[model samples]
Target chain A: MIDAIVLRDAREHWRMLLSWAITAAALISLQLSVYPTVRESSAGLQQFIEQYPEVFKKVFRIEDYTSAPGYLGTELFSLMLPLVFIAVGAAWGSGFTAEEEEQGTADLLFALPVSRVRVMLAKGAAAFLSLTAVGIVCLGTLAVGTGWVDMSIGWRRLAAGTAVCVALGALFCALGALLGAATGRKGAALGISVGLALALFVLYSLAPLVNTFDAALPYNPFQWTLGSDPLTTAFTPGSVLKPVGVAILALAGAIAVFQRRDLRQL
Target chain B: MTTAPKVTPLRALPPAEPVLEVRGLSKWYGRTHALDALSLTVQPGEVVGFVGPNGAGKSTTLRILMGLVSPSGGTADILGQSALNGSPNVRSAVGYLPGSPALYPRPTSRECLRFLQRVRGIDCRARVAELSARLEVDLEKHIHDLSRGNKQKIALIAALMHSPRLLLLDEPTSGLDPLVQREVERVLREAAADGVGILLSSHVLSEVEALADRVVMLHQGRTVLSAAMADITGRLVQRLTFEFADTAAESWFEGVRGVAAVEAHARHVEVTVNGSQAAALDAAAKHGVIAVHSHEQRLEDVFTELIPERAA
Candidate 1:
């Protein structure tokens, strides 16, 4: 049985976790329901899409509006799903440390006999578990929506895409955790996590338009998550491995920083 | 000097191994000194009162002992284990109540206690129930809805539930009502009787005087006084007020060997005596003293006398 901080964190966040999972499910279902209509209007939609600037279409991952995966990728995975996960991840990560310190609860927490590393690891595990739950919910909802829409999307592809989403979410969650550990301030953690995610998104989007940025695409976190188009491509180990590796590194960094720094109560 | 009150432990016990020890413990935040080369020890079953004004490193020392903050130099030990690198076994034997405890808002007091019980890996339900009843805390009430005193009671219950060997309490009676304060004091006494070592920090001098076997007074991040309760009491100055037939000059009492301070009004004078009062009384009697009233020195007065700059 998980003890102490992990169990306490999970209990505290039960409602927020449920809400995030439900929101993910709702957003995925709502977008997938519109897929058939988008396919029906593809000819008209393609003409409208052509009028969109090349950079905008590329930024939004607008390609083959008739295909199930392509349409879902553009409408749901490209922005909406990532945004939801980022928000959830950032909120959980920041709350794990920074918010506790801000509210003066860290004093009570650190007073326990457990080591700081153990506490940090427990909180990290809780955040990862929450993001994983949201990802699983999203995959289940996506499968249900596909069945309802009479779409022939493979379960394997959806699983692969969801895996990519989880990895991406974990990456940003780790970013938030790192900032939370470093700053011991919730506002700074949230701001830096969201700001970094947005900056990476913008950088990845502009890579094709600008040669200078295109050269940096391989190293970009946004590219690692969606650049391979997980819905269409076969599962490539590197695609998932890179983000997972980085997420692990970030979490490790968070643990190290938290262990060394004083547990400040705001 | 007028005789200071003879202070003694409310309950006497044989000396035992130190349950809490700090040797040359120092902490610095950049250029500001939080704790200087401070050292102290708490023996088993002893209550050591940690006294200091605001920003006087009392909290810093407690934080260091709890392993919530790293020290710049020196070592702190609890039960012979390094406190700076605390372990579950070590922490499980220790109970701490922060100066300003903030429990999770979402949980009811019952739920919060349950969580702490699980975290501490102790079956403390009976103890929790007993403590909650004693402290008059409503366990069913959500912590967010409770008043500060009620919340403090919940924290006190949590800290005491496990019956740990050592209790590091920071302002334990703060924000509590007099009734609750008395209850807490009783609990501390009971815990000490159980051979639990306690290091308590508070702004309340009377609380310290009542409970501490030894009083360690800190000023500006350093220990100014560390003595047995009796010694601290013996150092306290007596305050004497005299109403004289004729107005007396302040210098008359000042000339007395034991008089520490003298204030003269129109027909009345107040004298603070450090040792024997005979010389001061004789001086007042020579001025046609009509009536003389003497007051035992309070702990607060002693604290101010020790830390004069703070008084100023």
Candidate 2:
């Protein structure tokens, strides 16, 4: 069973989550509505895609842009979907315990019968669940939109793509919360998490253009989630293992740090 | 699942371990000493008044017991368990009210209390309603909509609603009006009757004087005084000012047994007495004193007199 604290957090911040969901749903609907037009103009797209340099094609993963998987990957799964979920993770996770301390509610909060580790873990879980809810909304929108757009891509691939977003979201969520738990500063948590996420995105984006960055792609988190290309290729549990492991490590660090440190005096 | 490390129980012994106990507790932040070798204990059903001026480490001591802040040294035992790394079960048996209740404004008072009740895995609805009525708090209003005093009242309700065996309250009624403070005092008295041990810290010594069975005064993170309420009050002197119908003479109170001194000018007489005011008071009445006003010694007066000698 989920901790009541998780439900409390979700209830407290549902408006933010709903806004994120509406944006994701709207973006996906607008993207899918153009797939039929792109597929009908495939002959012109092939010549148009060929005129670009191989560097441009490789950097953007612009292969078979007229196809269902490529159209979805280039426009949806690769950047927008993952980034939206990462935003969800970062926003919800950055305030795990730091917000309570800063707002002076920590006195009443820690005064309860719950352990510090339990509260930290519950908040982390709540952040993950919020991101997962957004991912579900994306999945549901994609599943329904596929039928309308006449895209042959199956729902399993959509689920696999969304699961990748969820796993990647968990890693950033854990990192955001770890910063909050260790520093007791929400700004540090939010700024550093979003900054680190953008840095990772830029590094992964330039890997194909820069030889040195290409060498580090094996270690890049974007490689572990998006680099697998779940939409066009086979989806396997092995793809998520690395990101899940890193997420667990970050969460464990958060729990250990929060459990022993003296809270803000307030 | 991995098993946790085991340790032996604490060594020092008490005949009957108190609900809350602290021995030689100290906390230092960088170069500043927040607490230094302070000690206290509260037995079941006992109301211990924790009194001190600002920076006396009174709030620090309570925070240490509540496990919000860690002590640099010594032990704080709650329900016979160590407070430093006590299990959450210890918190279940304790209720704590901070000097100020800093709550988020988005939620109503009822919502905030309900969130806490859910976390504690207990149903405090009945207790919440009862406390709200007694304290005259509006549970329906948002926390920000309430005044500071009303917020304090809601906080008091949250702390007391769970009915814990032990309570640590720091300036529980600081922002409350006299009427509300009286209501809070009534609630605390009733809690004590149910065998709840309370460690109450306050700058308002008069409120402590009204309710505490034992009073502990802290000075510079040290216990300066600890005694029964009767013991300290016994040694304190009382002064009386009288408005007389006719001219009074200082010689009239000269032979009064308990009268320490007397001054009479025109129709006004002031007499100082130790212990009982009966003998000196009767002596002044015989001298045509029409109206009398007796002033009891305040803790601040006693504290001020002690600080000059003790701080050194």
Candidate 3:
């Protein structure tokens, strides 16, 4: 019964998930197509990267820009891939959870014997799975693309970076679900979650240049995702743990509000 | 147009136990009170009509019983459990059809029914087929393409497939044609005969009078009247008009028993009857009446008579 909600959502939105996976693979192939040029002029590019502000290099996780892990991390996972994952997660999270209320179907859904908490969790799970699918597809593309470009970004490193992206996306998914349930308005939920994600991303990007934000970076979700250079370094337990804990908190808050609120739309 | 007996003769009856009970149930949306200390009860095997005008707290009461909305203050019990936060099991025993029920447009009626059936942990393919056939529902059609009546049939099927112990229907026949309305009524009657308690809410007094064993009336969020259908028909004052063959005169029917007032003009005489109109009709016969007309007592008329200050 619980799976029924999740399954129906997946069936309804499989096309969205498939399109995102194709886009992620396309981006990876498009980026790797240029890796050979970077490798040919490694020393010159290394110097060019060093001339960037020390803060910018650190923010990009670019100690060795000529290497496959370094090149891919700076190009994709640093900004592009994380944004993709976050968008996918947020889209599914907000749209799926709030649609029943927005479309005036909550009267039918909530009238069932199922509890609201279960419905909330089911939607969160479906969104998380969509993000996970995109992450895996992105990882597969990166694995093959690095080899075709004559580089060795280790498989474990690729997995680590993708894991971080997925975890970050999951956190955003829970946040989107929370907003959707709290407001019962899909547009508002998606707008606020995306707005908040973009704001936090900007802060994370600029934090290295601003010493004042140094203390907060340790707790920031975006920081947890890429701050340690997961593609070049090992993925630590804390990397996934922090975002997961916050996701749980967000989901708990969502369930608490959703269970008690009156279905105003109906 | 219903011609059901105004008062049915008494027959041996089964013992009764109320499946729904409410006391002082009040709901306030901010400062606007929707239900004002309303009280009601529906016993097993009884079809109790919850009749009122639009915005008369009928929908609010039903929503509270379904636990879709909570009351500001009061107690409501459905099937022996508190209706405020009734559990899944409590709801499982009760089937509910919301007024203007919301359904997913993407799924065919069959798909929608399967999903709901799976949620209830039951396989209802046969019942689905049967109910769809009985209601003339197009199971293969997508809900978005279905007409309003067809969509309503889908919702009705969902409400009845589980064979629940109690049925809480809000304006169940609002959009139905006469033919389909009669079919739904027949289905409800059959369910009631199986000892199911039914609370049917509608603004149409005639519909309730024809089907309900008892009727409760609401006005401005408060219960203004509650009684058996027979008692309601008997207690209500009605008007009758008699057309004369010759000159219309107030004198011929004067002082007739049960005739409260008479106004005459042209070839017709209008009489207000307090109880039996037999005496007045007898007088009209002697006066060579050519035609007779009974002014039906609509639900709105009842509201005007019972709560003139507020209803006006």
DockQ of each: 0.41, 0.39, 0.45
Identify the CAPRI category of the predicted complex in candidate 1. Answer: acceptable
| After superposition, candidate 2 runs with Cα above 4 Å error | B1-16, B240-273, B276-293, B307-312
Candidate 3's residue-wise lDDT over B1-312, tens digit each?
111112222222345657888999999988998899988888888999987767889888888888788889999877777778746656766788989887888889899888887776667689889888888888999989998888888999999998877899988887888888989999999999998889999866677877899888887788889888877777677899999878888988789999889999899899999878899999999988989999957555766677665544
| DockQ class, candidate 3 | acceptable
lDDT by residue (tens digit), candidate 1, B1-312:
111112221223346658888999999998999899999999999999999788889988888888788899998878777787755556767888988899999989998888777665557799888998889888999999999999988888888998888999999999988998999999999999999999999898899999999989888888988998988677778999999777678977877889988898988899999867899889988888999999988767767777866532
Stretches of candidate 3 above 4 Å error? A53-61, B1-15, B286-291, B298-300, B303-312
Interface RMSD per candidate (angstroms): 15.1, 6.2, 12.5
True contacts kept of 2: 0.65
The 10-residue segment of model 1 chain B with minimum total lDDT is B1-10
lDDT for each residue of candidate 1 in A1-266, tens digit (9 for 90 to 100): 55467767888898988988888888887888787888789799888888888768776768676688888788787888888888888888877778889899888877775666777778888888878888889888888889999777898889888877788888888888899999998888989899989988988988878898889999998798888788888878777789889988998998888878888854
TM-score per prediction, in order, is 0.90, 0.89, 0.92
Lowest summed lDDT across 10 adjacent residues in model 2 chain A is found at A1-10
Query: Which lDDT tens digits does candidate 2 get at residues B104-198?
Result: 67889999888888787778799999999988888999998999999998888888998988889999998999998999999999999998899
How accurately is candidate 3 docked according to DockQ?
0.45
* Local accuracy by lDDT, each model: 0.84, 0.85, 0.82
- Summarize candidate 2's per-residue lDDT along A144-241 as a digit string, tens digits: 99998889999999999999998888888888889988999989998999999999989998999999999999999899889998998899785677
